[model samples]
Target: MKKKLLVFLLIGVLVFSMAGCGNNAEKPKSDIKVAMVTDEGGVHDQSFNQSAWEGLKKAEKDFGIKVSYVESQQDADFAPNFETLLDAGNDLIWGIGYKLSDALLDAATNNPDQLYAIVDFSYGDKTPDNVVGVVFKAEQSSFLVGYIAGKMTETNKVGFVGGTAGDVIWGFDYGFQAGVQYAAKELGKEIEILNQYAESFSDVSKGKAIATQMYQQGADIIFHASGDTGNGVIEAAKEQDKWAIGVDRDQNYLAPDNVLTSAMKRVDVGVYNVVKDLVEDNFPGGQTVVYGLEEGAVGIAPTSDKHVPKEILEEVKELEKKIIDGEIEVPYNEETFKEFMKTL
Candidate 1:
């Protein structure tokens, strides 16, 4: 009887240990998997792609979702990158930037039931039900930056640079011009404004060339809507002993002394919001999600040790308050741009 009882206890221990191992294995299988497709700008461009990646990472932490990504080497590869992630069994796929719009539209059409979200682009009329278009009201923030640059420039001349002249990016350039115009008109000052586009988003040399020319022409402060190319802007600013404003991210850290401020696009917030909705089964589809000053989606970064003037800072703060209160409206699109110009 003693031998039989000892054998029985050993069998119980083995069974209990196996059951514990089974539970541990099952726990990992329950994790949700999310994935992303980056634009040709690539992940480390330190701009839009980087911001989107940061947001997706946040979702992974908040919801315990498994995250993965594929970088697109060029515009031609956008669709392939999207499809590759989808084929890998990603629960939802994110497409970063407007350059991926055509590819996303094509992929959404083919996959019909596939879940995806896009940042910075949209289908004007017929958006896919499974795709969410995340966009931002950059004009609102650009206006504030323009105000600061116009007010702070010692030369009374400011310039704007863009990666390309597309309607999407040009929106930032025009809005910036409007903002500078507004500050100039309101303050009863004649600030010379120069604007140029490099037509290439990744060419640092070209960006630097354009910025140097603008600076030589009397622009003491320059704001750029360029991507990695904007790195060139900072480089040029430092070389020339002038100041440049950054964009999309806190690029002030990139050039501490030369960077005055940055026009933020808040891409990370958009990414986090979309993924959160997806996890909660509240994915907003067939709609354009707009992030603006009111949503805290766009703003100017704080003045660095570069130490912007107190008066300029105060004026910008007041204008920001007015914008948030709906007392001052910023414009989007080309047609409304004319009206925005009148206000400036």
Candidate 2:
């Protein structure tokens, strides 16, 4: 019996030694690192760029990846930042905002072997095999807010302030206008909408001045798509004790009483998804990712009950459903959108 026990103990020791050796023989996973380039609005602007940064930070936490970022001081820095990130041996480079599209395209083309992703814009003709484009259907949420404003307006007057004049900014403008018109027609209400563009995203003073003018013109609810510049619009609304809608992330908390609802663009979700894909070895390159109502990437922030009426809340819920169910179509271009506005 003693001899048998000794033989069993020897066999167990040999098995443990072989298993430990095999474990050490396996190769470690490659380290994945990502970097982001912010547009004109610096990081922590509490808007679009901030949201994207938050997403990247989350990816860093989840994947154990080294993350770095550079805020572009001027437009010229976009290409240089991309070059610096690639040259630094980053596994992926992310460009935030539509303003960087041209630069991103140039850099991505020059560095064909480097993987790149961008938000808010895409390559005009064809995307390179290593480049991924991310865009949001901001109209989904903008439409809901338009419906709410049209219903809640006492003077039949609403306003939309855009950050720029182009397809990118107009996408929000046209969508909001269409939503207002749709609700006005169906609800048998009369609401007038005033639309204007600030021509830039960083000038908060200009946004404030424009918003103040709209209020003087009898606009009770004004929606500003400008970045930090929109904060000035909110300030104007607060000073006047009127309502202002926020864009990209919830600004309702920024001014609880004055902010009605936010048109959420889910920029963070876009950044997180791309990083996750790269980490999981499912990189979605050479593809344009469109996040819309169905994906929960673009929609309206929940209305803080402190400001909005219950009826308005119910109306927004119904509109969200229709948008998701495909019963309502929001117009997205100037000409077609202008015709739709006539119905309001």
Candidate 3:
């Protein structure tokens, strides 16, 4: 009788333990794999691709999920990289640049049920139900940095170096110039703003040459929206003892003294938030998600204090708030910018 009772108790304990284990099962997202196909500049560009990878890494750490990426060496590699990540069973795949728009459309169309994301490109009403577009209001942040350059430039001349000619880069270009124009009017200084486009995001030498020429042309500070090409801009700034404004990331570490400030685009935060939304089963498919100053997705780098004065930093903060509050409207393209120029 005693032995039977002991055996019954043991069985009861085992049943309870099994029930608890079942109740404590992990969420489905734990097993979901995520991957990205980098742009031509690759993950080491220290800008777009790099920030996206950093976001995935943070997602892996926070969610206990696997994350990976495939770097494309050229335009031809884009389609193949997408295929590889998709074949590897990635539950969510991201295309990291506007250049991947065509490839993303094709891939999303072929795999109608497959979940996909693209940064910097939006398909509008034609977007597939399984795809999401992550875009940023880069103009807002560029304007802040441009204001900073306008405040700091002692030479009364500034410049902009760009990688490509597109609506996206246009925002960076016009916003910066508008800010400079605003500051010039305020300070009663006739500031000359120079501009250049290397037509390639990866050509470091061309970027350096542009910066050097701008510096020689009496422009003491220059802002760049070029990816890795901007690295050369910073290098030239350091060598020439001038200032260069970085893009997409806090590039102060590259040249602590020469880097005046960076137009911080939080690509990492954007990617991570999208991953979290997908894991929570709230993936916003067929939508163009715009991250802007209001979303805390873009701003001047925190390292700006290393060079920018307190007064200018405070003004930048106020300007960002005004923009978010609908008081200060930053222009995005040629038409809007022409109008904004009139106001400044």
Candidate 4:
């Protein structure tokens, strides 16, 4: 009996050791130490910053690599925050927003040996050899949610609120407009769409103010591409019992009943892909990779089923397939939108 008991104990210890071998927290699985620097919205904004962090965390878990991040309280903190991360000897550093374009560029230029990746910003021809830019087709996701709003709105008046008037935000702006146009045209009726820009991404109060004005103007459904500021739009929707669409991440949890759905941009995938490639020594540096609908980089939140109808979801899938199949080209800006509208 004693001999058998000792053998069982040994077997249990061997099994446990084997199971925990790769994930032994005391011993990192990879030599790559990764880090991230958040935008002014910080790491907890539950949007781009948060999504990017989730991706890095996932990479750290899968590869047993060390990951860390520093939040920027304001625009002035961008350069210094990046400097702090770079000084920490991180093998890879990620910047969470386009607001870090200049600082990231300067860092990459100054330290050509250091590797870097920026989410939501494409450096175009100015891309550095040591850096990679990860961008998404945000317009594709925004248009689907807009279609939902157009079909569901009983008032026939919808609204759009933007964080800033840049090329990035314009994708959300014009895509939503085009979607609403498409739906209204198909319905053989006119749907009034209102638009506004907060000019800042951090001001929640300003977002609320703009959304309140839109709601008072008889618009029932409002979609926002504002970062942290969009929280205010959701709040206004809850207060007025209207519908507000979220962005970047699934924000339905912020106001379950009030938020119709969210346009989910897979920022995590972009962050993870870069880290994974680096770990495998197949790093795609000095390149701009675009993740769009076909790549599963952008789509509506799964939680949409809670509010959006099945037929509408099916319609979204069909339209999404068309977009992915190249049968439908979703516009990214005003000029393209004008040309696209002429085709319809």
Better of 1 and 2 by lDDT: 2
In candidate 2 the C-alpha lDDT for residue 166 amounts to: 80
List TM-scores for all candidates, in order: 0.88, 0.88, 0.92, 0.91
Ranking by TM-score: 3, 4, 2, 1
lDDT of 2 by residue, 130-223 (tens): 8999998887788888877877787889999998788778888988888888878877867889988998787889999999999999999999
Model 4 clash tally, residue pairs: 0
Which one wins by lDDT: 3 or 4?
Answer: 3
Query: In candidate 2, what residue range of length 10 has the lowest lDDT sum?
Result: 22-31
Model 4, residue 64: distance off in Å is 0.6
- Per-model CA lDDT versus the true structure: 0.83, 0.85, 0.91, 0.91
- Kindly list the per-residue Cα lDDT of model 1 for residues 225-290, writing each as its tens digit: 888788898999999999999898888888888999888889999989987887776888887798
Query: What TM-score quantifies how close candidate 2 is to the native fold?
Result: 0.88
In model 1, which range of ten residues has the least summed lDDT? 24-33
lDDT, candidate 4, at 274 = 91
Query: What's model 3's overall lDDT?
Result: 0.91
lDDT of 3 by residue, 165-238 (tens): 99889989988987888778889888899999989888899999999999999999999998988888998999
Residue-pair clashes per prediction, in order, are: 0, 0, 0, 0
Residue 102: error of model 1 in Å? 0.8
